[model samples]
Target: MHLSKLFENSNKSSPKRTGETRKLFLKKQIFCILYLEEHKTIADLCIPVGVSIPTMTRIMHELMDEGWVTELGTGESRGGRRPVYYGLNPSVRYILGIEMTRKYTRINIFNLQNKAIGDTLQIDIELDNAPGTFIELKNHINQFIKKYKLDKKNILGAGISIPGLIDKKSNISYTYPNLGQKPLDVVFGDLLKIPVYIEHDTKAMALGESWFGLARNRSNVLCLNVGYGVGLGMIMNGELYQGLSGFSGEFGHIQMIPDGELCDCGKIGCLETVASGSAIVAKAKQMIESGTNSIIRKLVGGNTEKIKLPVIIEAAHQGDQFAIELIEESGSYLARGLASLIHLLNPEMIIIGGDIAPAENLILDPIKQKLNKYTISRIRQDASIFISELKEHAVLLGTIPVVMNRIFSDEPYINNIHNFNKS
Candidate 1:
């Protein structure tokens, strides 16, 4: 049976089905809310769900009878009877989350409760937009499902957090434009024989923060992904702000220096050129080759080619002046970019995530110190900066909301259900 049947109402006739469609829509919203934050009483659910007490109670009962929800004991009593707490049934459905970078891919299966069914599988597949890349990714995903013995019918959809310029409306990835004649999502959906939703890597991280990390319930946030390259994800007015072309958060490409190093995006002075992981490595290699003294030389056994961001961070941890200076320089450059973001957006929080996040105070202290000079005191104080605790898993966890939003966002619930059934 198609997964759409899960949302279908039993009565689908003239007067009998007058409010069935509205019930179906309400059912979708209730599921999404429960999926996001579990264990809500009927009273707790009515306001956000915009339904009355009896209506919510009836819907909750229906969802429980359908095996989508479960009663989890009772909550505190105000005066009379204690309210029953309800939540999603962990085994009712599953979601597949995939995080793909230029160098590797990670996949995991999650139940409705957002708990992993098994260990996350990491496959080393160089993502160069080659047809073979997708082929290999499909093979790995297929094998992973088999290893877990999960029924394909029970898995709702797959969410991919990939590095690319993707238009969610068109489901096309401009970065991998030559991979297929059809849209990238269609290509993957065909290969996997399931619905697939794709999102840009940085924005995916932002979604992760919104749903699972520091940005949750916050109105305005800026998530900076500082790894292989600098990337930005913005949550404005409690929504992920994908710009006119779904490319709004290209924070890395914004010009920071007038005539600095050329970025891979074919522009001069992109912020990533000076403040990203790649930039940190580039500076380290240059200085090492030029005979600058540092503990990094000892760490890498005098091989500059082996230098990377983590090594420099390690050197700084050991009190190496050169490494400390490199991080400080990058932090200062990052501050310059952030100052502009503060003045323009006035976000409530700034989350620093990705490979360089482990640098911790080494990176935070500098950015904070420099902000004092670069930003207005009141404005800077309004935006609290934090390092993401979600760490390596941020992008992966993000795919959950991306898939959920795609399923629940727009079109009439019945039409969406019918479309899924047809697909």
Candidate 2:
């Protein structure tokens, strides 16, 4: 609620601060009031930004002139005449958020208020590690923007969330078609003709949960994006913790079974082999072929290759023992893997999202049962696992925090953000 973007250790105020500094400070204050917080009156802003009512009013008027803030209807009645509420003018800027997964690419257009502006589009395409893959993906985005009739300049930027080990400093994908280790943003941004930003899909999910869902305002939290492969995102002490190489949260590749099923990551018996959507489908196929007494066999018409996470979840919901057992088995493996995170981070909550999230309690209950059995009581007590409130949209909504964090946060002030942890 401090509202100002100044570094914590810097001088709080300078009446003599001249020219650009004063203007930038004023903009940041107005930005917090109109964008971060709900409808604000001049009085609502004074206390937080340390400005007088008159001064705040002047700054607000200036922001309005710049098309950043707009006057809404009056606030609630309080006996006296109500003050006018100021809100952010959403159309002043828009952001395109793209979430690319193994099976589909989703595009969501968001206004400055972080609210969806149009129908979310899901393009069925595989995010393959092949030549010209990014080009094809970019073309789909072009068609999407044109179909929506969006103006090029009005789009502030586009944020991409992709499945890979993305280096934060270099912005290069260590896991995909970098085409000579070039930053993906450079290649993709050139095609989009706007400033582009990219983040790991899991990290984006964690950001979405933190900003708009179950983990709102939570400092120490873990977010697991369980889809084709499992990915983990850690918010340690109030900041998203990207490891030194920005590849910290590789949840899927953790070795869970030694010398077991081979993983796409070129490893054997990784956690992904047991808990990911692909893993669930693969296991379900084997069970169907083995004459497992389950509804999934009938739902897919005995086509083992047609089995997917959704069908398995549907069969489980119908009380099919085989489907239930398979999900329980996956959850148990996931819980076993997460026990390590609980020990290392001691996070307050763990938010799970992606395709498996819709299974809700059917999938979550087993994971909790495993945690209860395996995790130390003290460590487990600190964290409560929650299904993501944003559900399948978590990855798409996550693009908001990723781009916003980079856009608004000063690099120096980012470090100044305190990490609040429990002992």
Candidate 3:
């Protein structure tokens, strides 16, 4: 879509040479929606939105009058009077996103600008595909909305992220049994009485990083979700790469150990067995239980059963040699898998996101070093690897784009505003 085309915003505005002017409702609507992603002044919006200063000013005024835009003070002075900037009126709309993984489920509300509101609700519930599971989740959503005092009408929609196999075509999770009986979007939409979109947890992480974090505006990136399970979200040609059945990006299942350790998928020696959060905790527990002389034992009060990924990471941070070795081992395994990815995709960037990313150099440094050893020099040089700055919030916040895109696909924002004005 050459959506960059602008239109004249006023009757007296001149026609543009290429892209449309802001005068067309469709042009102005899309441009304004893009601008809501970040604050901007009329002049700042011209080139990208393909509108002239006068046209942009007129469109901005229209949006402001409709309660979709607001003045956010002025930018730095270039010379005389500083130009006033504008941002989205966050309260005009809200989106909810829920991220469910093997270990826990996190749900939160966000504004158009991707700023989360109120404290995030995180529960230790594992994901299940049974009808009762969604019923329980729907109840939670109701309570959360009531607690926040959010009017149901103001909430536009919701986004849900889940781990494992998801068939986007049928909206059934192959990995989550009992949900294949019906289409998931319809099920959730009916329960919530609002639109709902679903995506893979790793895909949600990739979208979050692409929309609000490190991968913004970049094409051909690889986002590795390094959490309890290792997964990948591939952005190809500036879009998500979900192959047939929407079950792509299972990077962890690539065999590395060759009958090393049995995986939860019933596969032996998958990369996840050696490189994921579960692997990290399992390895730490093994070392402690086997009397490997690690401070993790002290952190867990000598109870190996109590050991978790965080305790081991803390021990590594405090200079525990055993913990450091364990992390390095996992990083090495991860690098082996990423090395394969780099050789095949040669992505512009490889982003490390999710829970364990907080460990930073403890794991990242080793992964880079292993990449240097495993990946071709030319390929490794092209892909810049880094940790996601959003940390734990990436997946939960991905709902903003998911819900917004769903709404945008159905009707133009101008029409929605027109309907809002009528009521």
Candidate 4:
């Protein structure tokens, strides 16, 4: 039976569906809980949904038969006989995750257990909003599916995380205003012939950190994506806070160095202009070109153009004082902007991610030093800063929750017995 049938046929209401609707709601609720918590006994599951033991046992049997749930042996016995534990069937379906940045794109397939099936395929596809960009992306997705020999029927959906201002209610990307203003999810969905969901890259990163990385179990957090351009993803009050229009965390554009440098966003002294990867590289290149004694020129083989964030970080690691100073300067400016956030949001954890994350303490130390001077001691003490452990994979892993949330929200329970009736 195709899972799409369950989602597509969920909304038809009739007197005959009264009992099925209630049952479907319960089944979905149980599925969601098990998806998050993994294996659980019928008795354990019943406590959350307020369902009777007998009723939950019956539903669990039905789910197992439907291939949506599986019995994973037994748990330790507290008394008498041991209890059986159930979890989502890992082989039942798959999810496609696509993480796009300004310079490249990555694609991978994930199973129901949130594990990647194969190596993530990365390609150089610059996201410039050209008409050919989507076509190129669609072609790669097709190739990835064919390469993996994935069953189209079993592929549940695709989740895309890209740099843009995505409107939550309309699901439209306002940043790519020149690209006909179509919702990115719709375009990808039509091309892939599967349901697709879209999310801002940094916001999705925050979701990944919240679910699988260091931000887990932490209520208030700030995920800073210190890539070519800096961006922020905020987790406020235990939820991913997407402000009105899903554009809450535009941390890069905040003014920092009054009349210092012009930003690509048509602003002067934006935080990105001073503290982003691009800014670090630009500073390194200017310093090298000025005949400063540094190993960065040798690392880039005399090509200043090749001196990117990684090269600068490598130089800093190799005891190059010039490179270290550049990173420290960037961190200093970053701390100034973050100090304001500390005073305002008072986040519990600030996660630094992206290309600069590999520098680790080199960047963190300077930011910590500056935070002391700029922020109130009491407020700044509440937020602990650290590099993201998820690093590059955060955007891809983030796609999981983005797609699942959309799936569970819109899909309802439909009485389609023929699809699942296996006697």
In each prediction, how many residue pairs overlap at the backbone (N, C-alpha, C within less than 3 A)? 0, 0, 9, 0
Provide the overall lDDT of each model, using Cα atoms, as 2-decimal numbers: 0.84, 0.81, 0.78, 0.85
Best by lDDT: 4
User: What are the per-residue Cα lDDT tens digits for candidate 4 across 1-423?
Assistant: 323455555445233534667677677767777776788899888866658999999988888888999999997899979999899998788889999887899999998899998999998888877878888888989988888788877887888897867788777876642255677778778988988888999999999999899999798999999998888999998889998889888899999878779998889999999899999998888988999999999998999989989999999999999999999998999999999999999999999998899999999999999999999999998999999999889989999988887666654321132122222
Q: Candidate 1: worst 10 consecutive residues by lDDT?
A: 8-17
**For residues 1-423, what per-residue lDDT tens digits would candidate 3 score against the true structure?**
222122111223343334343344444454445544367667766655555788778767876776767899998899978988788777777888888777677888887666778889887765775567777878888899899899876776789887888888888877753376677778878999866888888988888888888888798899998878899999898888899888899998989887688998889999899999899898777767777898888898877888888888899999999989888998999998899889999899988887788788998999999999998898899999998888888888776777665555543443554344346
Error of 1 at 271 (Å): 1.5
Please identify which of the two predictions, 1 or 4, would achieve the higher lDDT against the true structure: 4
**Candidate 3: 10-residue stretch with minimal lDDT:** 1-10
Score candidate 1 by TM-score against the native: 0.87
Candidate 1 residue pairs in backbone clash: none
| True-structure lDDT of candidate 1 | 0.84
lDDT of 2 by residue, 291-331 (tens): 77788988988777888899999999999998888888889
Candidate 4, 66: how far from true, in Å?
2.5
lDDT of 1 at 258: 86
Question: Which ranges of candidate 2 are over 4 A from the true structure?
Answer: 1-17, 47-55, 76-81, 129-132, 411-423
Q: How many Å off is the CA of 292 in candidate 3?
A: 2.3
Score candidate 3 by TM-score against the native: 0.83
TM-score of each: 0.87, 0.89, 0.83, 0.92
lDDT (0-100) at residue 344 of candidate 4? 95
